[model samples]
Target: MLLAIDLQSETPIYTQISEAVIEGIAKGQLQKGEALPSVRTLAVDLGVNLHTVNKAYQLLKQGGYVQINRKQGVIIEPNAFPIADEAFKQRLWDRLKPAVAEGVCRGVKREEMMILLDEIYRDLNKM
Candidate 1:
């Protein structure tokens, strides 16, 4: 997985890392069964403490996005993706709600958003 952490972000480092990986998964930038870099490698790449990468891996594990193993390091555990936790779901909507509202303000219909979602789903599946 390719990642760039923003030390300048108001969000936590783990969160920055998690979101990038999750979005990469959703967008099919990282495919099922692809190996991600080890946490230490990622920390070195991002110029952050190794603990930050470990924390981010823990979050990804909690979110059911990746599997952390002693031998394989952090790897993408493909198939059977689960629904995100309720709070995370709410947080996602909180982020989307405003964008949708803005789209509505710009006269984009709700069906358009649904169609867009479908398109992205189709595209990702094609990957």
Candidate 2:
């Protein structure tokens, strides 16, 4: 999977890296057990600090999205992926609340928001 990061984005570099990897998994571009570039390699390739890539990898490992092995380096979790548990649901809801609130503030109708959401969901799945 190719990762593109915006240096100027308000989001932190590590967050962007982690999110891109997550999105790749969601899109089935990064299969289970697939190995990712080494942290140092990715950092050099992306012109970022090694710590940034390591931080992203650490987050992924903590989330059960990847495994780090001395021999294997980093790979997507081979045995299983995380299910959307209550905690995950709560996190998702928390993250989405702002966008929903923004829509509300802008007087966007429910149908309009739903339609927009549908379009984005479909677009991501199409990749």
Candidate 3:
């Protein structure tokens, strides 16, 4: 899995990790049944605490992205895809709300926001 971590980003590390894994799946870069790096390995590689990686992995497991086993390690679900959860929804909203508000503060009209949103949505759908 390829991830770009920004410690200074407004988003937290765990959230960024979870979102990156999910988006990798969405972008067809991460396939179902693929094995993920061990938490310890990833922590060492990323120079982060083991607990951070564990927390991220736990979030992925809770979202049904991957399954963990004592001996088998972590395996991406056979059909890891869309996950609908209130927490995920709220996280998305919290991230977007700030950007949207910034645009609004800059005098972006509602109709313009709708247009921009549609264009962005279409661009993402193309992926």
Query: Estimated TM-score per prediction?
Result: 0.70, 0.93, 0.75
lDDT of 1 by residue, 22-59 (tens): 87887788877777899888988998998988998899
Which candidate, 2 or 3, has the higher lDDT?
2
How high is the CA lDDT of each candidate model? 0.84, 0.94, 0.83
Quote model 2's TM-score. 0.93
Tens-digit per-residue lDDT, 1-127, candidate 2: 5899999999999999999998898778998999999999999999999999999999999999999999999999999988999999999999999999999999999999999999878866865
For residue 34, what is the lDDT in candidate 1? 72
Tell me how candidate 3 scores on lDDT: 0.83
Q: How far does residue 28 in candidate 2 sit from its true spot (Å)?
A: 1.0
RMSD of each: 3.5, 1.4, 2.9
Query: Which numbered prediction scores highest in TM-score against the true structure?
Result: 2
Model 1's alpha-carbon lDDT is 0.84
Ranking, TM-score, top scorer first: 2, 3, 1
Give the count of colliding residue pairs in each prediction: 0, 0, 0
List pairs with backbone clashes in candidate 3.
none
Look at candidate 1 and tell me the lDDT of residue 127: 58
Per-residue lDDT over 67-95 for candidate 3, one digit per residue giving the tens place of the 0 to 100 score: 98878898888874556678879988997
